[model samples]
Target chain A: MKFLCLECNTAMEFKETATPDQGSLTAIFECPDCFAEFAMHMNPWETQMLKSLDVQLGGKSEAAQPMQMVRSFLNQQNPDNLTAEAPTVSTEGGGKCPFTSVVAEAFQEPVEATGPVWTPEALARLERVPSFVRSMAKTGIEEFARENGHTEITAEVMDTARGNFGM
Target chain B: MKTYKDLPADGGSNIIGQVTQQVNRLQQRLASVRHIVAIMSGKGGVGKSSVTANLASALGLRGHSVGVIDADINGPSIAKMMGVRGQRIDYGDDGVKPALSPLGVKVMSMDLFLKDDETPVLWEAQTQKDAFTWRGTMEMSALREFLSDTEWGSLDYLLIDLPPGTDRLPNLVDLLPNLGGTVVVTIPSGVSQLVVKKSLTMAKKLLNAPVIGVVENMAAYVCADCGKTEDLFPSGHTEEMARQFDVSLLGKIPFDPRISIASDEGSVFVDQHRDTPAGRTLIALAEKIEAFFNHEV
Candidate 1:
């Protein structure tokens, strides 16, 4: 039977087309797109052939333990494409569009709105300004907020706008 | 033929989105310009366009990269004054290519769109009595479209020749992000200065634009034969405005009849006569402008 390539989900041919050996729990599948080989558990093992292969392969005997041994092999090779049965790789910000990396690089730097957010009380005081100079007065207040490093517009900022900035 | 090519190519489905796109396009186009200045007068009969043409020519001749935008939507004369009148704007791989003048100043104007000298730009609104009543909103959009679409590659200076009054100032002023400043033009008469003061206050308080200085055009008459200066109009208001408004007093220009004559003849007086008193003053004005941008003054 054909199996799905873990990385690209493409149908890939198995190295051995016949029915899996009885009680041989693991089978090897190769992905054609990424050329990564992964071991998938096929059935339970009834014999100690795994132990014999482990001795021949000269590796840790733990790799021959059970159905979980083959899954660990799949985890190492296709780490990013895992599911629960088949889990998707989800990061902190969730899945990103494949096309957005270049655009994200451009917007990496953002202008910080460092000034204090305008207070309603101060905004009401600014309401006394003539319509003609309203924008100018608001800008002066914000500029004062930024230059003075205040996180919120207080009575002091309004006083400065009135006296120094000619509001 | 009607040429609306400067307009954004949308068929009017999304108005706000299209205008925002146009603004984004203009910001990208003009980002390379170092200084954005406009020559404005509070009233007409101030020879503002002539100053713009000659000043841009002087700057260009001084080896500075300068471009002139005749932002006078209704009465565009920079094309004629710069001797680039009747040159048609074309579309190449770039956007609307501004026509270059004989002095190498990239000039853009609505005059280039008219078929002939007699054709009037009547952007009419539907009225009960008048069929050809021009609309202010239409004028603003057209000016914005032209300003946004022109492919001015790069420059050290872009001097916009604004139409007189505060009405259309927003049309051009809204397009510039960092306007180096405006060179407010006015004659020396009290009436002219009084009107110009309105513009200064508006710029400082309303527009929040920096007013670099005031240029007193037609301030005096300098006799060519006797080297005597004559007071052509009341001569004290410019300095008074400068002192009261806290704006700099850039040099003054004498009322030279030849200045007007040369303008009408489509010749740049600053380039033709550098030794004449008026020419020297023009060159001096150009120097002061250079110093202002250079932060030397």
Candidate 2:
């Protein structure tokens, strides 16, 4: 977890962390003496393990909202009362940690880029799936499409991906 | 070459600090609660949830502020059995408000957050393949949230209804090192006691948490029309099992058809049929539990 600059033989300091990419995370560290930077790439599983622990990469800058982990990560929550309004985060101490911006920027939701686009018909079909498993099913179908070289997701691709999902 | 111990910190991630903070939050939340009891049965279909729902209701009826946590994340039934299913929960300044039963028992369960009766609990993930690696961790985290993030607000008793399997007690002990005691449930059948004994060993010998007693559910069949009691299964093994484990046999709850009917209708059986044999036993069991906490045998 710690990085050392061989040339300078000094410990590195945490510089920044990039937003997660495909469930992976990139953290940049810089040597205090040499001013050289190094980026550590964590695989998807490692990133998810950290998320499961509910810890920020650089460190927690703000106190967590009550049930913040469940509220932020539970994909198919009961929409009636859970999504009514965003609860105000208590900022009693007001970001005293030095890595405030680093953690705030690091935890943003990952954005999918250049992935297979879902057609209206395909999306409508996906809506019929049970809300709890819909996110996982959609991820599976999209991954299947990418593996099969399907640029655009349609009903046909979903049907072809059904066998892979054993649905 | 400097080794891992030579490094000052884990590059400022401070994972240990975060975990300690979570533990501290749970401890602080539980501070207001006097006693934390876990209701567990290693055998499936032994009616652990039903016992938990009634015990919580019984305590509430006795003027104790009670809360119930359905720790069976995948198979949560305490909310339904306690008549709090589908109740809307809101976030308060302290934590997420728990669903209130008709008896005013605070209840939290995965069932409250689920979409429908048919929907199973599933976490959002990139892929379902090899989920065994992280699924258990996710469940533990969810359980932690249920413990520390619910606004229980000064309770006399917090009853946790645990799912089947001998492995569950270890998980609970990890979360609650100061778990007050455990009440193990079993049936008269030798098969049921076969599994319940393992849980007794786990709670008494392995984990060393106090074993309150053993409850023998479905000990006899109380006929509705004839008003006659008959042996439901091979009776008397539960008493022998308790003796073998050197724990008290708390009570023997008869298999009253009304208990099932009331549970299906989201009603408490003891509230309606207090004079019945099963109801009286349940009420007395609640008193025994209170006495255990008061240092009175």
Candidate 3:
């Protein structure tokens, strides 16, 4: 398809269109006169517009399939933010209800993540996660103690056991 | 938090900058002094200061326009030894002028700043501060404002009588970058000989100043009654050492009982005993020193 070159303001032909996995769309258009490759916009709105146009040009409708549920499950399981409202279904006990599963999943905090950052949000979440986990874990243990009718149980007992057992 | 730019539009406010400027000043000019000889020894009891006083006197007597700067900041013995104690520096528009010794050399010392002659330097780390004061005054931008600063004018030689050691005030000698050289003094004794070696090595390493020669003071005691010479230590250790170092042998000063008495009487040895052996040796050494200055080695 023909298009107006953004840089040289001349007529140009579309060279290629590449769709990125991370919701970005890029279109390479070559100017005939200046022989320059003019890059289109890079924001989300531009990407959405390019995708819609691709569908109108007899291109297959690239349905925005929501990310795989398991992929998101892995992401929500990120140790970065314990409060990120992740979906939960207890794998060990399918008998547990959704709320109970969420509580269990949220309480089962991962060990401190020391791996290289794979995303910006992951880094930001990492900074805030440790303290959040500590408080949530404290609340969870206290709730477990009360539920089991062991209301008098204290952190000292937990600490002693952890220390003796090499927890 | 005032920056260098916000300094009070005056030179005195920025002391560090002023001192740095002064150090650079000496670094450029230390080697330019016609004759810069630092007199020092490692041990203090060896009468290094008295020897410095008299040697400077002897040099002045030979008609050289000499200036003796007492680097012994804490224990400035030059004023008393040179018999210029309690003398106030003459001040006018120029700066503080160094007091003239009886024998013609211009003499300066920190002692002159004391309120009285009997005042002992009681400051702990007094030596360090004195050296600092000397370096500051000698190099600072404010030097032009003081009269004492003006006294160190052009001269044939500037003899610095340093505090007896390679440590403490010896670093002050490094301040005079153009220092002509050094003269190591030692009394005739095994301990003094070993200590004087340290001083010589320090002069070579720390000051990088040349050791023109070594002078053994009180090498032999000559009895006035019998006219027989007693070997106080080994008679010619200084000579042997000088030969080893390949420096000029600047003769020895015998343990003339008269030298002590003359010093006590506020008199220099060469002045009292111009015909005596000790005086003649000093004269000969002075000749050799003059020869060194003249490049007639």
Candidate 4:
């Protein structure tokens, strides 16, 4: 049967077999040209469909979002997967991804509110901060249990719509 | 390619839990000591060990029971300076009970552990990891095991004489739980000032422990014959830096030949020269330090 490499857009052939109880739950298929290994549990039909849609496969492919691809692969592998029992992704301060959620929450709040307040200037400051320095600051904050004391910088630019007039 | 490894076939969920429980137990044991202060210097030759020994002595004289652990694995001047030089440490059932000075401050150092005075701790990353980690781990194991297994009874302070720079001291700080604060020592010079800033930044970055303040060593020289104060190195930078960092400016200790003599004789300056400037400054610093920890500042 014909199949396509999910990582590389190369056409390939596969030998069809009856659902012999393959001891391993995971399926491993090797690409002839690229010599790249691809693993998935999709049957011949689904592989053909994906190939027809021009989906690329293998090492670090940019075909789709990795997590989405993972989810799709899981769904195809087993409908009775245990991911359904996985808790909802929390974005609050207590969530696993607390920094992003906290920043988002801080941005949403007004300056005088109970939560962390950030100005546009502060956002620019965050962007301007080197990743290493930011990491150091973050580590310091966590280790010392201190506030995120970053001062942001911003500059005013004239808008084209406003022209020469001041807004 | 994404590398994925499965859990051990043993499938024991208790490994992480057991390890965590053990670590928590260790932390509790370490927290038994009321206060632990690491004495650090930005640069070597700034009299860090001398300051630590004297400060511990001053604290001891003040009726506060203090333990001095010399964390300088490479150059341990504490044991010798404290007058317990060449004394062999006896390991009891509990742990290594640090030898006591004449003033009764418990002292421990890497020197005590070495077989010979010439034995060098030539530790490398491939051989012993970073010098900091090796020294720090040795210190933690020594101090923690000492505190936990031994009969220290009740103690007010555990003063650690840390190695020079932000480099080695941070590692020791990491191992020490519930560290009261740090006393950063520096000489009165631009180079020392730069190094002190590095030390300050290191303390801020590495640990959350409070900085007691910047203690300026060799602040000035007083000629005995002339009876005039001369600025040996640049002055006021220590105080200025302390003010900038929002920490106290402990005190400036003058360069005194008498201090060197006292240290050589295995005695503290405070005991030898009570009225001398360095001795008096240390006493004042002790008082202020007491106030700081006691919340009377």
Worst 10 residues of 2 chain B by lDDT: B123-132
Best by lDDT: 2
Question: Which pairs in model 3 have colliding backbones?
Answer: B30-B177, B30-B178, B31-B178, B36-B180, B95-B146, B95-B147, B95-B148, B96-B147, B96-B148
lDDT of 4 by residue, A62-105 (tens): 21111121122111111111222122222222112111111112
Residues B194-227 of candidate 2: C-alpha lDDT, one tens digit per residue:
8888888888866657999999999898888888
Model 4, span B1-297: residue lDDT tens: 211122121111122332233245335544557888888876888889999999999999999887887777567789888988666554343233467889988876656544356655432111222334233443434333333333344578888887776766555554565778999998878888788888888887777688888798889998888868999986778888888788888999988998899888897888878788888999988888899988997
* Per-model TM-score of chain B: 0.90, 0.98, 0.80, 0.85
Writing each residue's lDDT as its tens digit, candidate 2 over A1-167 gives 67778888777888888866665688899888889998888886776666666667766455345555555455545544454333443333322222122224475532231247666678678879975467656767877897899878899999989977786
Across residues B2-56, which tens digit of lDDT does each residue of candidate 3 receive? 4434433222122233334335434333233478777777877777777777788
Per-residue lDDT of model 1, residues A1-167, tens digit only: 33455456555433322222332334344656777766655332211222211111111011111111111211111111111121111111211111111111111111132135556566556657764345445556766776777667767778975687663
lDDT of each: 0.61, 0.79, 0.52, 0.55
Fnat of candidates, each listed? 0.00, 0.38, 0.00, 0.00
Quote each prediction's TM-score: 0.59, 0.84, 0.54, 0.57
- What would the per-residue lDDT of candidate 1 be over residues B1-297, giving only the tens digit for each residue? 212443332221222343344456556667778888988877888889988988999999898888888878678899889888766555433345678877789887777765457656642111213322224543554455455445677898899998889766665566675678899999988888888988888777655467878888988998879989999987788998999999998879888888888888888889998888778888888899999878898
- Indicate the TM-score of model 3: 0.54
Instruction: Give DockQ per model, in order.
Output: 0.01, 0.26, 0.00, 0.01
Candidate 3 deviant stretches above 4 angstroms: A1-167, B1-16, B24-33, B122-150, B168-170
DockQ of candidate 1 (2 decimals): 0.01
Give the Å shift of residue B259 in candidate 3.
Answer: 2.0
lDDT of 2 at A138: 73
